[model samples]
Target chain A: MLVRVKSRYRPVAMTAAEAMDGRVRRRERNAALLYDAAAELLATRSLDEISVEEICRRAGVGRATFFRIFETKEGLLREFNRRLTADAAARIDAAGDIDLRAALGHVRDAIIEAWGHAGPGHASMALTYAYHAPERIHDPHPELYALVRQRIERAMASGEIPGVVPASLAASLAVINLTAPVAWTLSHRADELDELSGVLLDQWYAGMISTPKPDRRRNGPRP
Target chain B: MLVRVKSRYRPVAMTAAEAMDGRVRRRERNAALLYDAAAELLATRSLDEISVEEICRRAGVGRATFFRIFETKEGLLREFNRRLTADAAARIDAAGDIDLRAALGHVRDAIIEAWGHAGPGHASMALTYAYHAPERIHDPHPELYALVRQRIERAMASGEIPGVVPASLAASLAVINLTAPVAWTLSHRADELDELSGVLLDQWYAGMISTPKPDRRRNGPRP
Candidate 1:
């Protein structure tokens, strides 16, 4: 669990636990400052236009400090994305012992709320991730995938989503279909970003992916 | 109908009809030469590394002539994509009032065959199209969508795939899912490009794109 921080640093000597706590708080505060600065800068300018020095200066943090927190500028966006997924994962976990459909509703609602605030910064982040390393279908955003995998496994145990298809593909399929709008916003339909993700997510939750291992033969044996 | 040309031009004076024929032939030849040269160079070099002058030089065509033939290098790619869609559309049309699933099988086979020979040129072409202008979910690959729309209408006419969903959405869904591999080739799973498209297409063929309206209420009124 991340301990949210309030202040940057204190020079006075203290107990080892107190010192570690101060370090954690300072680290988190710096990360939060850098993220806010990046978002503010990216609101009016493209990623290429914003320099690291500007972000550091705006955050009131040293350049070396910024580097210590994030390996690259994109690391900030990735960390933010990780938080969003973690939030949704927690919700999915909280839905324990409930129906699968209701659990997926949490996933859909999480996306809707997230994209509601998405600006050019978010769009650029998504594009960078896509171009640098496309999400692997087998495993992507591992923690969230792991949680969703467990959910699917439970569904399969109950035979809700058809136990025939492997739980792995089902989870990946569900995750990718649900998350497609992030990458899609970089396209011409960007204007429809907020609305489209909602629609796609709704459609996904409404019906399961075609999991029935229907006559795969008539398709002529996978070319 | 496209008149495939064998050679560039012959300047001998001829009748008006012959002159028109020569112009069409020369125009097509120029476009083909540029496409082939672009593909050959792209095989070894990234798109950013190659220049228009180099492409023209390799094609033995002048820069002015290249510009006349293609609005932009990306335009050449768009045309190639157009050709691929045209070929698929032709096959779909020739299916001529056949069963819907069987016709869809023709669409799947067409994608598999095309991707088998896809190279970096095809991958770059897909990315350019994806970034510049996304295919509208309402209408994509116009010629192919039109034909598939008609086919879906015919199926609905016979109540085959069920007439609940609009033929327009169904056709668009089919086209987008079918062509997903072209854009997907840019991802890390690119090695599976040829194989994955085959599977997705088969899944699509085996089942419809969730045409059933199903209980949308349980998903919480679309966020």
Candidate 2:
């Protein structure tokens, strides 16, 4: 089941295949075949090693059809990331009771799990935003960002997170922090990633729970 | 004085010109010409819009020399960021007494000021690492990371920042968090970027300054 995630500036391109609607089930079928074939190939090897021709041959689809659908091989990654984000949104949405603080851990676990299943080739492509999905500079993960922002807003309303930080900024910052560690997992620095995230999250928690201390430069004794 | 920022896995390739070393200063001179031409063109137009041919023309160098010197147009960006990182290090190294707390602000201002001077065209190229310089999976900013790590270590020693968070993690996180904001500046969200960074920085401060509170998950009230 395809979940439709909303975004403010989404480049939801109405490609010719989608425009034709029900007229070309073949196009949709071809797209699915390519997606599955790409996924299977990516499981063992990096995206760099895989080719469009190989993907077409594996899928038993014509080489001409591959171009008709995806303009380039990287299109597979965009589709892959889109599905990943959608699936993440679905799962996170279902777990309605997880607090704002636990959400980062949940997201981190999700990324780790996904990478483990797919291997580094697919993992790197999905994690990257600039090259993979350069169409929209604003929404890195539109569906998930919405859910995260909502949670941050709820936290601020309940005083769980300090209301001082803007909800949008908080949500974006949270997502960026947690997603960063995925690349480190490849380099055997997963432990460092977790430790650093702990420091970052801990400091964030520290700031929210405590009041601002008076300036050290203020010439006075502590109250 | 090129500040050679050290890294563990840096692929410092000795291309033909560098391999020849002093034998062919002409190749070196041609490289400088191409680099300067790319930099000047990048001031007004993006890395995308400008072509190697245009850069060669602007430099008054042959098109073949462009390939001989830089290999690709994006090579200019790799050199550009390398120099930018080096310059930032030199400046920060000169400001020896600025505390760890102030370093984030310094880096942010440097990025912001650099963006202002270069415009969005060059701004985007310099800020992005994956596309421009994808060779290294680690060492996003080797020089800055070293300096930031040292500062964090010093802060930990002084008890200004909590010693719980590891120094390496702290430095990596600091650099990543501050760098994330540059893309937003182009979208007219510069103010929001500063505000969000404050939220992030404030939280980091909060964590370091305060002891871990007893868990809200615990059955008993605060001790």
Identify the leading candidate in terms of TM-score: 2
lDDT of each residue in B121-189, candidate 1, tens digit only: 554554554322223322212444454566567666765555544455556555454444433443333
Candidate 1 CAPRI grade: incorrect
Global lDDT of model 1: 0.51
Best by DockQ: 2
For all predicted structures, in order, the TM-scores are 0.41, 0.41
DockQ value for model 1: 0.03
lDDT of 2 at A25: 61
Scored against the true structure, residue B2 in model 2 reaches a CA lDDT of 15
DockQ of each: 0.03, 0.11
Off by over 4 Å in 1: A1-26, A36-58, A63-76, A97-104, A117-223, B1-25, B36-60, B63-79, B97-105, B117-223
Interface RMSD of 1: 18.3
